[model samples]
Target: MNSKIYFDGSIMTAELIGEIDHHSAKNARMEIDALIQQKKPAELRLDFSGISFMDSSGIGLIMGRYRMMLLYGGVLRVVNVPHDLERIMILSGLGALDIFERQGEVYECT
Candidate 1:
């Protein structure tokens, strides 16, 4: 997995690239968790435009981040999910959350 995290004050944006599978889930989660703890963002955006594949591990990653952010009263936004992952998100009933298609941008929150 390829990833980078950018933070502007309390707003953190994580960009995920390449395949999101068991192979990279551990490292990815560590890095993202580190960033989240360091930044303590009021809002976190997980950008998935560059993610080509997402398996069950990816689902776990999403849920983990969601719970982490919720603990701090933070908001999580998933953005640019491709067709297949979008289908999964929809089927999993995660579309009710703040997953963005084309309208993802920097957002500030309390």
Candidate 2:
């Protein structure tokens, strides 16, 4: 997996590329969590514009981030989600809690 993270003021954008399965989710989780703690960004933009694949572990990662941001009184958003993954999120009932950002085309895990 390849990731590029940038912070604009308090909004951090973590752009993810490649698969987000059990193989990489652990590392991804650590990296993202560390950044979240360090920056404590009021808003986190998870840019999935490049993610090609993801498994159930990816769901856990997302949920964990959501909980963290909730504790911080912040928000986590997913951007440019792949159609397949979007369906998985919807079917998994993840969409009900996450707000899909239509303007930028992403999901907000609030």
Candidate 3:
């Protein structure tokens, strides 16, 4: 997977692309964690709009980031998740966390 991070005030948005799996989660985690540690933003938004595929590793990725953000008293928001992946995430109990958010035309998990 590949990602691009943007900063808007105290909110840092990470746009994840491609596939998220065992092979890519580590690098993505490292990159995102580095920035989170360096900037300590008030919010971390994980944009999954560009993602095409994901596995259990994706769940781990999100959970890990959520924990990291909590350590710094930051909120973690997952947005723009595709329909298929959204179901998977919800089934994994991520939806229950109330972290999924709406972004413009993107559907918000309820």
Who wins the TM-score comparison? 3
Of 1 and 3, the candidate ranking higher by lDDT: 3
Sorted on TM-score, best first, the list reads 3, 2, 1
Q: Report, for every candidate in turn, its global Cα lDDT versus the true structure.
A: 0.79, 0.80, 0.91
Tens-place lDDT per residue, model 3, 1-110, is 89999999999999999999999999999999999999999999999999999998999999999999999999999888887797778668776677887665434444
- Candidate 1 has an lDDT of 0.79
Better of 2 and 3 by lDDT: 3
lDDT of 1 by residue, 29-80 (tens): 9998887887678998888889998887887888899999998889888877
- Which residue runs does candidate 3 get wrong by more than 4 Å? 104-110
As for candidate 1, its clashing pairs are none
Q: Clash totals for all models, in order?
A: 0, 0, 0
Q: Each candidate's TM vs. the true structure? A: 0.85, 0.88, 0.92
Task: Give the better candidate number (1 or 3) by TM-score.
Answer: 3
TM-score of 3: 0.92
Candidate 3 has an lDDT of 0.91
**Alpha-carbon runs more than 4 Å astray in model 1:** 99-101, 105-110
| Model 1 TM-score relative to the real fold | 0.85
